[model samples]
Target: MSTNAAFRLQDAGFSRAQVEALGEFLDSQAATKTDLIEAKTELKAEIAEVKTELKAGIAAVRTELKAEIAEAKADIIKWMFGTIVAQTALIIAAVKLLH
Candidate 1:
């Protein structure tokens, strides 16, 4: 950036301490800009890593859920067959008793 204000202050014969303070402020601003850029780059990289991990975790959970659903279906079918057999036996016993 232009140091117009600093130059004007110098031309207007400001104290040596005041001019040095302005120089220090300009140096700090430059260092701050560099630090901000580096921080932004690091944050972007970390976000990408987290996104990848989340995708992998979601895929694993989906696979586990599908397996559990299939097991539940098998259990339901087994219970249905057992129920049908029991009902048929009960009906035959009642018919024999009536006879």
Candidate 2:
């Protein structure tokens, strides 16, 4: 049985085959790096889109809460005014009768 040994540039001296193989390896690595960079760029764009959506959601919630708070405050004011008016009228009638 015969076995073919792999050639090393250092052991065999510089040859056209060695240089071509190195070039191919370098090209493959470059292609892989380019793919990774493109993927990272796409991810960043997606993240930006998600952040924009989140901000809009938060703003909508704040606006709704503000409206609810204003309604609650108005109801409280109306209740307070009605109570005061009724109490004052009763007190005036009682004083008038005693006199």
Candidate 3:
């Protein structure tokens, strides 16, 4: 608090002891401008770090999903080829019977 302000408070029906107590209360409860700025900077840095980690995690999941999808596609293709061969062999046997 400034000298003028302190005097003003005293003139406005505040006791000197009351003004001193008010100053102490405000000092204890309020952060300085420098303290607030530093806190904001630290919070921003932590947020940026979390964002980087989250991106890495998402990319890893995407890669795993792609690999799984490729494996499933290969399994489906193998099953299809097996079914085709089986059907062709059955047709050949039926034709031989007719002959």
Report the number of the highest-lDDT candidate.
Answer: 3
Q: Write the per-residue lDDT of candidate 3 for residues 21-47, one digit (tens) a residue.
A: 988887788998999999999999999
TM-score of each: 0.67, 0.60, 0.74
In candidate 1, where is summed lDDT lowest over 10 consecutive residues? 1-10
Candidate with the greatest TM-score versus the true structure = 3
User: lDDT values of the candidates?
Assistant: 0.90, 0.81, 0.95
Task: Give the Å error, residue 76, model 1.
Answer: 1.1
lDDT of 1 by residue, 31-93 (tens): 577798999999999999999999999999999999999999999999999999999999999
Better of 1 and 2 by TM-score: 1
Q: Model 2 Cα displacement at 98 (Å)?
A: 4.2
| lDDT score for candidate 1 against the true structure | 0.90
For 29-83, candidate 2 gives per-residue lDDT tens digits of 6757779899999999999999999999999999999999999999999999999
- Model 2 stretches astray by more than 4 angstroms: 1-31
